[model samples]
Target: MKKTIQRPVVPPASVSTPVVSPIYPSVVYASDDPDGLDAQYEGGAAGYTYAREGHPNADLLARRIDALEGCSGGIVLGSGMAAVAAVLLGLCGAGDHVVGGNQLYGRSLRLMAEDLPRLGIATTLADPTDMAAVEAALRPETRLVLIEVVSNPTLRVADIEGIARLCRDRGVLLAVDNTFTTPLAVRPFALGADIVLHSVTKLLAGHSDVTLGWVAARDPDLAVRMRVFAVTTGMTPSPFDCWLAERGLATFALRFDAAQRNAAALADWLAGQAGVRRVLYPTRADHPDHNRAAALLGGQGCNMVSFEVAGGRKAANALARAADGVAFAPTLGDVGTTLSHAASSSHRALSPEARAAIGITEGFFRVSVGLEPLDALKTTFAAGLAAARDA
Candidate 1:
C-alpha cells in the first residue's frame, strides 16, 4: 500500500497481460466461424475455420499430446501413415535423402521403399541399433533420419538419445514413431527427437474402437509446416473421431500400466517354458537394447512382447490356434490380449528377404498384452505351448 502510494500510474497496456488457455476450451467447427470463412483462413476467428484444417477436438487432442511430448505443438491426422507422410513431405523435398530404420512398422517400410522414391525422395534403411550402420547410411543429401522407439515385431529399442545427438551434429531432422512405447513409457521429443509420431489407434486410444494418428514437434515452425501439409493434403480426422480418441486417451495411462505388467509377467513365464526359443520384451535383461530401453523408457517397457516358437511357422500357427483367451488378431494394443504371426500378418507386405533381414523369423509370434488376469493368460499360453510342442 505504501509503495503504491509513491508509485506513478502505469498505462493499461503496460500493466499486465491476460492469460490465455493453452488449449481451446470447447469443440469448434469450420461452420462455427462468425465470418463464414474457412476455419484455417479466418484471421480473427477464435475456433476452427474448416474441418480439414482443424477442429476443436483435434486441437484439444493435439494440445494433450504436445503436453505429454514436452513439445511446442502437435497435429492430428486421419491415420498413422498420414502423420508420417505429413512429416516426411513437410521436411524434405525431391532431392533430399532419408535414413530410416530397417525394422520399422511394415507399412512404414513399404512407404519408404515404394512410395517416397516415386516422389523423388530417396531413403536408406539401416539397423537403428548399429551406430556404425546408421552413420554409414547417412548420405550427403540426407535431410532427415527416421526411426521407431521400439521395433514392431522384434521389440528392439533404438538408441534415441544417441541418434538425436548424431542428427543434431549432422544438422538433420530426427523423426521417431512413438506408437509402441506411447508417451506413458517414452517421450521421444524429451530424448532429443525433433518430431514424434503416434498411431493413436494403438495405445493412446487404448481401445480397438478408434483409428487416429498424430505428430508432435519440438520446434514450433516445424509444427506449422506439418499442420499446413496436413491441411493441404486433406488428411484430417473427423470431429467425432477426435472426440472418441480423447475419450480413449482419458484411460490410456491406466490401461497401459496394467497391460505392461501383464506383458512382463507373460514374458517371464514364456522364457521358462519349453517350445519357446526366445523372448523379445525390452525390459528383459537378455534383450539387446535392454539397457537403452531402461534408460529411455522409464525402466518399464511396453505392452508388446514377441517370442520365437521352437517349430517355426508350423509351430507358431499351432500355438496361435491353440491359445485360449487371447485372440489371434493382426492389430495390437487392445483391451483383450491379441496375438499375430508377424511373417503373415504385420510383415506380410515385406519381401521375404527384407523380413528375414529384420529378424522377423518364420517362428516369430507377437503378443499385445491386455488388461487380462495374468494367471489366466499364463495358463492359456502354457496350454498353447504344450499343443505346439505336440503338433
Candidate 2:
C-alpha cells in the first residue's frame, strides 16, 4: 500500500456565508404533511408552493425592489409589457377611464389607446407637462392616471408631486413609470405616487440580458391585490431571470452613475452640434421643462439623449451609418453606447399625425449613452454628425 501524506484538519470557523443569494428554481416545494400543505395554501409563513405563485429568488428580488421604490410591497413579472397589462387589467374594467400621457412609449400608447378601448376602458391622452390639460382631460369615471417621470425618447419631465395632488383631489390612482430614473435618482412614494412601475430590462437591471419588470404599490392592500393579479395572469418572471436581475441590481449604483455622467456629457456636446436642430434633455437649462425637471430630478437626468437631425431622415440615416464605435440597437440600458431611431423603433406603432403631435419627427433619434469615455464618445458622435451635415 502506498503511503499517503496526512492532511491537516481545517478550522471550524473557516466557512462563511455567500454574498450572493442562491437561485431556488423548483416549480413546487416539498410539503411536510397535510397540515403543512394546508398552511401554505392558506398563505402561512412558509416556503413557496408553486413557481407561478412565488419562488425564493422572485421573493428576494421583489423585496429588494420594493425597498428601492419605498413601496410597501411589489411583484416581479416576465417583462415590462406583462407588468403593464397586469396593472391595467387588475385596476380597470368596462366603463372605467384612464388619463394618460400622449408622449408615451409606442407599445404603452397602443395598449392604452387601442387594446384598453377594445376592452371597454376609455383612455384620454394629454401632455403630462401640461397640468391644465391633464386636469381638463380627467372624467368622473377616471380611476387611473398614468404618466412617465421622464417621457421616453423625448426626455420630457413631469411633476410627480403635482400629478399626485391632481390624482388625490380626484381620488384616482397615480401610477408612474419610474424606469427612466431609478430609485437612486427619485422615489415615487416620497413624491406621493400610489403605484410605481419599472421595466428592469432598461436601467433597473442595468444589463440588456434581463427582460423583467416590476410593479410596486405604496399601499400594502394594493400590493396584495397586485400580487394576486400577477399570479393569476401567469406573468411571473423566471427563476433564472430573477437571479440575474438581482445580480444586476447589486452593481446598479456603479453602472447608473457612470452611464448618467456619459449621457450628460453627450447631451451637452450635442446641444452645440451644427447638424442637430433641437436637443431634448431634461437637465439642461435650454430644455423646455428644465425647471420642472430640476424640481423633481435635481438637474440630473437619466441616460437618454434625443435630438433631431438638421437634414431629416436622410441625415439621420447617414448618422446611423457613420457611427463607427456605437451600435444601432432596438433596446436601451446596455453597457456600451448605442443609437436607436425612436420614430422607427419605440414609437413606430404610432401614426404620422400622432407621431408629429408628440414631436417624434422623421429626423429624431434617441441615444442611450453608456459607460464609454467622453472623449471617445465625442469622437464617434462628431463623425456621425459630420456625415449627417454633409449628407
Candidate 3:
C-alpha cells in the first residue's frame, strides 16, 4: 500500500492553532445519545445540538463579547432588530411595561413604540436627557427601561448612571444600547446596566459587511431566556458573519482610534464653518449634552457627528452629491468616511414634526468619520459644505 501511494492523502493540521477562530458553519450536530441532545437543549450545556439553538461560532463570539461587555453571559442574533425583538419578547410579555427614550435609534424607537403595544407589552417613550422625565414615565408594570448611550442622529448623551440607578431602585431591568460607544469608551456594566445590546453591524464588525447583534446580561437566567428566544425566533446569526465579526473585533482599537480622532476634527471644523448651523458633538462645550457626555465619556466625543448644513434638505443633498472622497452611506462605522441624511434615512418613518422634535431636521446629516487623514477630510468637507451652501 505504501509503495502504491504517490502522495500524502491528507494535509496535516498546523502544530499551532490558527489565530482566527475556525468558522463552524455546521447546521446540525451529531450525537450518539438521544438523551444527551435533550440535555444540551434543555440546559445550555457544553455541546451544540443545532445551529439555531447554539453553534460554535455564535457561542465563541458570545463568550468574547461577554468578556468585553463585562457580563455573565451573552447571545448573538441575526440582526440588530432581532436582538431588540428577543430582548422585548424574552423579558416582557402581556401586561408588562417598558420605558424608553424618543431619541434612540429610529428602528429601536419604532420597535418599542409601534410593535410592542400590539403584543400587549406597553411602552413609554420619554426624554432620556431628563432624569425626571425618565422617572415619571415608569409604571408599576415596568419590566425594563431602555436607553442609548449616545442617542442616534441627534447625538444626545444619556445619563446611564442615573438611569441605571433609577431602574435599580424601581426593580426594573436597565438595558443600554452601547452601539455608538463601544466598551473602549465606557462600559455600561460598570455603570450598573443590567443588560447591554449592540448592533454589531456597525463598529463591532467595522467593515460594514456583517449585520449582527449582541446582547449581554448580568443575570444568567435572563441570558438563558434570551438565547431560547433567539432559537425559537429562528434568527440564528450566520457562522460566517460571526467569524467576520470576530476578526473585526481584533482591529477595532486601530479603526476606532482613527475614526474618533477624525470625527473630533471634523466636528470642530463644522462648528466653525459659515455654512454650518450647529454641530452636535460631545466634545463641544455648546452641545446640549456636553456636560453629561464629558462626565461619562472622559471628555472625548464618539465616532459619529451630526450637523445642520446651511441650505436645509436642498443643500444637504447637494453637499452629499458634491462631496469628494466620501459617500452617502445610510449606515455607519465603516473604515471609509460616509455621510447620511438623518431625516430621509434613520428617522424617515417618523412624521416631520416628530422628526423635528428630535432635532432630525432636513438639513441635518450624520458623519461616521473613518480612517481618513484629518487635513484631507477637512479640505473635502469644506468644499462640500461650500457647494451645499451655494446650492
Which numbered prediction scores highest in lDDT against the true structure? 3
Best by TM-score: 3
Worst 10 residues of 1 by lDDT: 21-30
lDDT of 1 by residue, 1-391 (tens): 3554334333367466634222333333325233555433745445454467676778878788778777757888998889998888887889999999999888888888988899999999998988778889998899999999898889998878888999998989999999999887878877889989999888887778777899988788888898888888889786676777787777888998999999998999999998788899998999999898888887987899999887877787788888978899888889999998988978899878878887888888899999989999998998899888988
The lDDT values for all models are 0.84, 0.86, 0.87
lDDT of 2 by residue, 1-391 (tens): 9999765333366368768887777786766688998997887857677899888887889888988877656889999887787778888899999988887777998999789999999999988988888999999999898888888878888867888899999899999888888888888888888889899888777778888989987777877777788899888899999999999888888998999898987898998989789998778889999998888887678888988988878888899999899998878888888899988888888887888888988889898889988999999999999999999
Runs in model 1 deviating more than 4 A are: 1-42
Q: Which stretches of candidate 2 lie over 4 Å from their true place?
A: 1-16
- TM for every model, in the order presented, reads 0.89, 0.94, 0.94
Per-residue C-alpha lDDT of model 3 across residues 166-283, encoded as one tens digit per residue:
9999999999989899988889999999889999999888998999999988888888898888888898899999999998898998898889988988888889998888998888
Can you give the lDDT of residue 111 in candidate 3?
Answer: 90
TM-score of 1: 0.89
The residue-level lDDT of candidate 3 at 231 comes to: 87
Q: Give per-residue lDDT, candidate 2, residue 363.
A: 86
- Considering lDDT, which of the candidate structures 2 and 3 is the better prediction for this target? 3
